[model samples]
Target: MSMLAGATLVASTLLGAGPASAARPPQAPAIPVAGLADPPAEFGTDWHDPLTAAPPVTHPTGKSCEVTVAEAQFRDFTPYKGTYAPPRGCGDRWSKVVLRLDGKVQGRQYDRLGYLHIGGVEVLRTSTPQPSPDGIEWSVEKDVTRYGDTFREGHDVEMLIGNVVDDTYTGIIDVKVTLTFYPAEKPAATKTATKTVAKAAAAPDHVLTLQDGTLTTPRNSERIVAEVYATGSGGGCEEYWYLTVPDAAPYSCKAGDGPYREVQIEVDGKLAGIAAPFPTVWTGGWSNPFLWYVIPGPRAFDIKPVEYDLTPFAGLLNDGRPHRIDVSVVGVPEGQSGWSTPVNVLVWQDAKSTRVTGKLTAHRAGDLTNSSTYTSGSEHRLDTGAGHRLTVAGYVDTSHGRVTTTVDRELAATSVHRWTDGESTDALKGTWTDDEKVTVDGHGPAVTTRTDRTYTMDGATTLGAGDRLRTVLSLGDRASVVETRGGRRTAWSRLDDSYAGDATYTANVPRDQRHAVGTTSERYRLYGSDGCYDRRLVTVQGTLTGVRDSC
Candidate 1:
């Protein structure tokens, strides 16, 4: 299948856009259909019944798998693939779609899922039943009511049951699908109201505000925007500066081979902050742009936003004097590790806000090291650094609040690879692992902290049928914890967490095309009897794919 692009709203380019002024964003996906007061009727879709093939027990593996499978494709050079666009559909909608994958069908991995596409747009995703005692032989029912606007008559709908996680399996399977349509009893109606909050057009004589005006025009407020993206094919492991948070931690870069850590920030030539890992999935990845563009992950419903507590800096920038600011990144130009980054800084101001003017300190395409050689004979081995860091700097007054600022940055990563028959095809198969860790703390005029934090982000393109991508992680005691005044480690958790599963996404495209990539993000939370800490947040509106080439 082909690769999938985000909708118009998700992963949109912020460059040249003015400050966010709309009360209601145009990207919101709200369907017009009324909720079913009664069970709706089903419109029989198409499918192959009567057991075309044998179903899987714990699913199937490599050779045992039997089904029309899909795979993840690897890439080397960066193709200027623009963001994904949805297909133009008939003026109609559906409420639901029922997908049935019989037990007789075999697939590669259960962790990853297959995708269903309609008219070239992803409409549904299917799960597997392995490792789970029950739930096997069960069917998956998805609510497509939201995307009702994207459906039409004679729409080309197809199902893909294979994923990149199983290169070892030439899986096979059978599929069946059904759709439920709802005819509006009456035409839907919408209401719109606009409210504007007036503010003095003049800044306080004593207030000074400085923000990065690249992604978005300067804004007046206590808000910040940061990002990560690639501009080139990332020779090996690429790096780019995101933002400078006066100083702290929550991010890291890589050390060659693969995974890496946060980017460090410096203020006034001093270590200022560390970039924390916060995912831009919701902002960049959506289900269906127009209708059901919601996050597929229950936990990441795309609501748990990332923000840095810069209120403490409010008092520092009150001096009215212009300050200097600079940001940079590091890494190799390899696969989808990471590349050119764009950062937008927002420091809302009144009379209490000051200024930050500085030079772009030590900035360059860092030379990531590649040590620890791996021997790939009978069994392949890897021993190389996987992470690195970034540092942004600037000059500004001190926050009068002197009140400590508390912020958390979450980090994560995932990847897929395929080692050809250099040794044995299965000997060195592809793997994809995702991890989340955070480093939370506090910093300000009253309390400035210094620490060494880094992260290694792993990204890869979708796997083609027979491609392999498995998780490869070796965490140590979640050692991402810190020692506060009390020997107690604060619990870093998903505050609004509803789902914490593996990184999974599916799309339906041309059989000649490959889509779906693996990516990870991490976070940090401070834990002290008296809660308070500091950290920086960096998000990448970038692509997550390995080289678009095969092993």
Candidate 2:
């Protein structure tokens, strides 16, 4: 019987008259509270009273009632049905006990809460404090209380009961209470009547079915879906499974296996899945293929065969510029050899479109040379030798001798490309259509290269202007500006990339530091790699004067 029933029995036995005052109505059932008692082992063989005496009934109000009661609750089983991470709902069966005063209802509480084991680790506890108009029949309240505890296989419940009451006529009260055991609902192999009721009213948002021994969520529109998959029960045999909700309807539960039904599915604070009830939706599950994540790009390089010798080259080719060796290749997918025949080369600065290519020649295993190139923008050029040529976009840098060359356009080359003796002489091919932006050293070039061959390396000095210039200097990191300046020789304050106070920036070169320039002759150092005849040349001359970055 429910706890409220017991309260009504006591109240009816004492209040012989029909209910009167608004504050004191016919007694209502009370919620149970914690009542577990220490076992017989704690008391030993000593004989004792079956009922423990109730303490004096004391309240803030001076008036006192004549009777008292006590109650305890026990659980036969918990409600969890499967090994779920977060147990979804309450179990199928539950019962409670209540004790109350003979003629009045004081206060009540309930304990012995229980629920299912989730993931074989957590206990899902659920309780409902209900109210009833008729003392015999109970009505479930809308509000539900739930909690979790660690799951233990052989768990049981125990409690003790005691209470006290005072007499309204003499200020003296009698107390009597008993401990009772009620069978708890256990998880059944098949659904029970009560279980069916809970399922019909509180079904989860998902449902699952195993096909060919493989589990799959057929599809449903239920707002709350409960899917069950059985892995190895014990002894370590395990399996994996998943259920996907393709779509959702507000406050609805949809499933793959059945017709749409209204249900509520909540994950965290937000609605994760919902669907409309009745009238099945969607013919079948959507086809979503398994996807592989993109792998990380390469970090280091193994050299490719890249070299050219314009030893026998002639002047004045197609662009009116003197000819030299130019070579190029398209990006080949991993494990494939040779380049793609370009109908049109697509050059892109982003990592997705650009391809990296590198070549290194080794004198021996330990001693080697490395040249690497990153392709940028791509275009189509048909006039060279092949049907179409990909644009030459990125700069090529070699490590052995610091060989660097910037390719601005597509150069002409043959389609029958091959490496013989790990060496090839082919002119760089492709269109120069995207070479609109230019940078000297690392700094932006405000003026076009055509407008000024005299480029600023950093924001400090100028390079080639008057022939009698002494020391030329350029400085900056990769992203900013480069300046250069030079003038007739004088003991001028330091005025290059370094600050004026630097020892190298001395007001005058100390006698010991006079060898800073490392030059006494008029000869300039040929600043070219083994591949280029002449690229950059550094020189020194008489009458040095510091020229700042005016341009």
Candidate 3:
């Protein structure tokens, strides 16, 4: 039972060379410290860049996924009593797991799997939180814990994978359960088995020509070159041609008087004249480089290509590997209560077309549906994806129960969208009363009529260039700016509440401000000065910016 859950955690702590040691608990099941001298290993390689294509392994490229699982030690951080000590049975065979990549068993250690048929014993769950590339390490999700009580039999487990510290790519890396069991007992560990998996050969990249045609070879040939000759008659003209190759003697052509005779022809490789019955002659052969001759005149002629044997330009391969590009589109589907499902767009460069088909999600119509004092206007939400710029420009007509939303041609948002039935009530609605019009509590209908069927956005979402850290702040004329970190919204207040006055105002990005550079935390504060507090609401509305890498 202990091996089934806690053992993986313990093993991960012992193997990982990170903060896992400090973050791990002393009482936690001990990691089996033996047999690492010759343990198996693998690598998970993502061959594509996020802006160009999806991983060929998962797409139509038919390439297999490369797996790389590093053995690491945990650095326990939880506070402990007096002298810190390791947990009991730290070296006992506690668990075992078989690693699999794309359904293929890749690695395994631990006899429990073979003996008892337990699947998860050999697997080790990581405790170190994925760190940001900026060298800052922070755990986004809590480490998985093993339950000591269920030790007799082993359980199944999986470790999520991706560029833990990089937010550029989409989807988590998943190592599936394969091996059957792991010995909970500790033994002298030996490490050394697989160093790295062999990667596939890179493919060639062709350069597009001015006409859009890919240029794979040069236009010069050496075998046989065809020459053209033209002749004009009383009413029109006529022409004929053939191929020849001059291995040595400098090649030349001629018309009348020359071996090949004609009026307006070529001789010693020179044009002569133009005449009917103009027997324009040429040679058909191949040389290191091929050449062609053009005769002018309005005439009829038939010619054949001279087969050539020559060396063309050798082909070259692309030294740069094709990168995986992530593409996602988020918007609300028409006609739904909450929000529409978020649409995920996926495209593989090795495949045809950039159109992606995936799932979507929806959200609430109003920003504050739970607030009792205020009624929200019509609105919906949508997203393109993290670090991507998305602009949604379209009309929402809800009066007929049909909601039509067309995003701008260039906009791509990877987020959820909501739908509205198209209806809102304000002071114009008279009062809030049930259809019975009994006036309910005896008080007059509320002042503002709550409206529905409105349209709004899920707003803009921005994530850190590496850690996925995000913050969003929105502003409006009568509305104060509300800021949200992660998903929690911050309370709003004037930059300086002491100031008293009725003034018109606006917010602006400081000209000298280099908003997104060199820092884990970026700051944006609301400021209200002088008499700018009561009179005008400076609605400074804009999506969060500078979360992705520096532009």
TM-score to true structure, per model: 0.32, 0.12, 0.16
- Where does candidate 1 stray beyond 4 Å? 1-258, 265-271, 276-324, 333-340, 348-373, 384-493, 496-551
Off by over 4 Å in 3: 1-133, 139-146, 151-157, 163-514, 517-551
The Cα local distance difference test for each model comes to 0.26, 0.17, 0.17
Q: What is candidate 2's CA lDDT for residue 172?
A: 15
Better of 1 and 2 by TM-score: 1
**Global CA lDDT of candidate 1, please?**
0.26
Q: Write the per-residue lDDT of candidate 1 for residues 159-220, one digit (tens) a residue.
A: 54443334543233334444433332223243221211121111111111234421221222
Tens digit of per-residue lDDT, candidate 2, span 467-486: 11122222110111112212
Clashes (backbone N, CA, C under 3 Å), per candidate, total 136, 78, 142
Return the candidate ranking by TM-score, descending. 1, 3, 2
Winner on TM-score (1 vs 3):
1
CA error at residue 347 for candidate 2, angstroms: 52
Q: Considering every candidate listed, which one attains the maximal TM-score?
A: 1
Q: Give the distance in Å from residue 121's predicted Cα in candidate 3 to where it truly belongs.
A: 10
